[model samples]
Target: MRILIIHQYLWSHYKGKIYSELQKIVNTHKNDELLVLQTSLNEITRANLGPVDRSIHQYNYQVLVDDYYENIPNTTRAKKMLYWVRKFKPDVVNISGYYEPAMNTVLFYCRLVGIKVIISVDSTEEDKPNIWWKEAIKRFVVNRAQGFFCYGSKAAEYMLKFGAKPHQILLENNAVDNQKIASIYKEAYQTRETEKAKYGLRPFNFIYTGRLMAIKNVANLLIAFAKLKPQNWGLVILGDGAEGENLRKYVADEQLEGVTFIEGQAWYNVPKFMALGDVFVLPSYSEPWGLVVNEAMVGGMPVIVSNKCGSSHDLVKNGENGYTFNPYDTDELAAIMKKFVDDPDLIKSFGAVSQSIIKKYSPEQVAQEMYDGFKKVMYEHK
Candidate 1:
């Protein structure tokens, strides 16, 4: 089978891991070919995260239009996609996002050529504002897809609203390099205190690693942390965005103690910071799938995820791996934070559960699911 995948960027480390694994799986099958089309070199919005390692073409089956800007969609995208489609003549085409005009064009062309179409869905209803015309167009486009793949149950549920049958939706949940990250975290865990001393971090650190955006509800996290006011516990906020300075100001104005702000670094260096923390918290008001939760779990840190996050449905088991709280409830978040401080033993126990649960979510497993989805679309479906 010749499969073509169209994605926005290969800049993400998590995406790199999944795609690399997929390529490995494809190599094992006789005459199976996989080609990934990267539309953009890097994202404009996340430029602060530093330069993307363009040397990520570990697979020989990728085509990157380094000149294109993914944020801006126009007729040129249709031309570019059709160009690749004609050249590749793939048996199946997997599109990255539903909203992109380029992906929609590829979907249309694939239908014309009797090529099976698969869409990678991550947008839950909470991720986007509900607009009738938007939903109508989305429904129309989604109904045309023969196969649906997504991050979790919530994402699969979102597909149902867009006209996909339950069987047509396959849960290709997000993953990180669990084995690699776990190894790195083990090293970091051994020397955690020495590292914490260098950075002036507390003995017990609760980490949040994402953009400092309003949607992330980080201000509420700060409020929750302030409520605890534990002398030995600290909150580490990693990543920078429009909300960075505002968050710094709030931390200063409130005189919040033991809240540390670290500038965002490259994807490879993230585990270094994750290793210094005892627990991870993602209190986003709206999130499709928080990959950081997957990373933290692989690193053996208990997570406090928002119910609003799509990953929480799968990655978090209340009081097992970690707790899931309402992002809107500051007091609830504070109470969960207090649990880690009050009982340090919970960190090791909860983190163990996190490690156990995270093992099921991996790039190899996602590739197998995706391959099965493609085969289903090709030969099984009537």
Candidate 2:
């Protein structure tokens, strides 16, 4: 069997890890082959994370464009994609998104050629406002695909709303490199005290790692943090974006102390900073899938994510692993944050549950599921 995966960019270390594992699995099969076609090296919004590190992306892959993905012309992308699709003649083609006009072309071509198409779905219903025409168009595009690889339960549900059958749902566990992150966290955990001292972080901290955009609800996180009475806890906001200066000013104006802002680091290096905090929080009004929550869970840290995040549906076990609150409610968010401040023991207890729950979403596990999905699609198509 020959499987071709068309991904948007090579910057996602999590996808790289999944592809690497899938390649190994395919290699074990006598005549199985896998090829990944990346659209670009990175996206413009993530240029600050630096170029793609080849060391982390060790798999059979090709980049169609060396420039940022947003800058790539639709014609060029479609032409290149068709060129590769025709040359490789894959038994199955898995596309990362259907919203791209180029992908729509490829989907039609693959369908005409009798090649099974699998779509990778990450968009949840809550991520954006729904429009009648847009949803109708999406249904048209979604119905053309033979199978789907969903990010989580929410994503699978979204696909169902667009006409994808339950049996057609192939893989749903979207994940990061659990072993890699666990290793990094273990190393960081050893010198946790020393690292905190180096950065002057509080004994206990609630960390938010992502772009400081309005949709991320960073301002709301700050407001919630401000509500916390003076304690040994602090709010560590990592990553930089347009809202950085304004957020910093808000902190100054409110006289909010113990709030440290660190510029975003490379994807791999994010786990190292995760060591500085005891709890992880993501207050995003709109998030398709919060992979950072996976990173945090793998690092054995309790997570307080917004209910709006896709990951919260599958990963967060309500009071067991951590809590999920509405992003728009500052009081609810603050109340959850105060739980950690009022009782630090919840951090370790909840974090342990998080680690156990995350084991099901490891890269290796997801890769096997993807491989199984490929075989199932091929068999049904035959």
Candidate 3:
């Protein structure tokens, strides 16, 4: 099938778990005459932590599009997309996000051509949708697209409120490669054991992996860590961003000795580091569904994620598998960390529960669920 995948905020330097699976399919099907057009360089394009590999087409989408500042806020994006539609004449035009200036522009093109448009949004929050224009545009294009795909059930409900029909919203839960992780866990854990001894492993190591943007609440993490000086916990901040440098400076100024901040590592290396952690935490301001949560869970590390992260709503069993805390409340985050520190048996017990739950998150299984979503949308559209 000829597909035209459009993601305006898709940067070539960015590496996501979705990229690994999609690229495998793209590489296998490149001979099938597939075209994946992508656009990027949104708000947090700085601190590009992409790999420097020359051989791998890590960021190369099947097709490429540019978004300049001058072109934004103008109708030029709509005109360009219309031209692309006519020239490419694809069977499917899948869009990643329906937010920002790109949302209405893509909606207009999809309406004009009567072509299939599939939207995959993170989620909408009751506190703040951020992109209020997106809600209005979604209602306007209620039946314009084939269907809408949400990361979690809560997000699906929110999308329906924006005028997506009951049958139109599908759940494509974010997952990780459990089989791949299982294959390498034994070896990686052994390697990490030796590596940790050499690097001087600290007790109760708390690791956070993801973008260090404002939404991640890295500052809140620092505040919580500061409260745990007498405790055994040490914060290991992984991933890079604009807030990364500032955060490093803040750590030094605050004289945070227990914290060790490593620059962001590549996507493939993340799982290994997660294996070394005693506990993993993600205090996202409002993440649709952080895929890294599954990565950590598969790595057998208990996670303390914010309630805003869409995955936390489903992946976290609230004290059974892992803990959940409010992003805005550092005290709550600190308390969760303290629980893990105070009890070593909790790690072994909860870690077992976490890993058992991760078995179902295999890539093969997730791919089937995603394919089901695709078929459902296509059949309903017909």
Sequence-dependent TM-score of model 3:
0.81
- The prediction achieving the highest lDDT against the true structure is 2
For each candidate, what is the lDDT? 0.85, 0.92, 0.68
Pick the winner on lDDT between candidates 2 and 3.
Answer: 2
- What's each prediction's TM-score? 0.96, 0.98, 0.81
Q: After superposition, how far is residue 71 of candidate 1 from its true place, in Å?
A: 6.0
Model 3: residues with Cα > 4 Å off, grouped in runs = 9-35, 40-47, 52-61, 66-84, 100-103, 126-134, 176-186, 249-254
Tens digits of per-residue lDDT, candidate 3, 172-262, equal: 5666556555556656787876766655667668889887888789999899988877456677888887698889889889888778767
Residues 1-382, model 1: lDDT tens digits = 8988887876766777777888888899988998888777677766767677755456644535565375546586677778888998989889987888878988988888899999999889888679999999999999889989898888998899887998898665778877777777777778878888988998889999989889999999999999999998999999988899999999999989899999897776788889888999999999999988998999878999999999999889998889999998999999999988999999989989998999889887887888888888877774
Model 3 has how many clashing residue pairs? Answer: 3
Q: What is the lDDT of residue 366 in candidate 3?
A: 51
- List candidate 1 stretches off by more than 4 Å: 54-56, 71-73
List RMSD in Å for every model shown: 1.6, 1.0, 4.2
Location of the lowest summed lDDT over 10 successive residues in candidate 2: 49-58
Q: After superposition, how far is residue 94 of candidate 2 from its true place, in Å?
A: 0.3
Score residue 344 of candidate 3 by CA lDDT.
Answer: 66
* Residue-level error in angstroms, candidate 2, position 374: 0.7
lDDT of 1 at 58: 62
Kindly report which residue stretches of model 2 are placed more than 4 angstroms away from their true locations once superposed: none
Per-residue C-alpha lDDT of model 2 across residues 1-382, encoded as one tens digit per residue: 9999999999988899999999999999989988999999999899997668777777899999999999999999999999999999999999987799999899999999999999999999998999999999999999999999999999999999999999989988889989889998889789889978888888899999999889999999999999985479988999999999999999999899999998898887889999999999999999999999999999888999999999999999988889999999999999988888988999889999999999999999999999999999999756
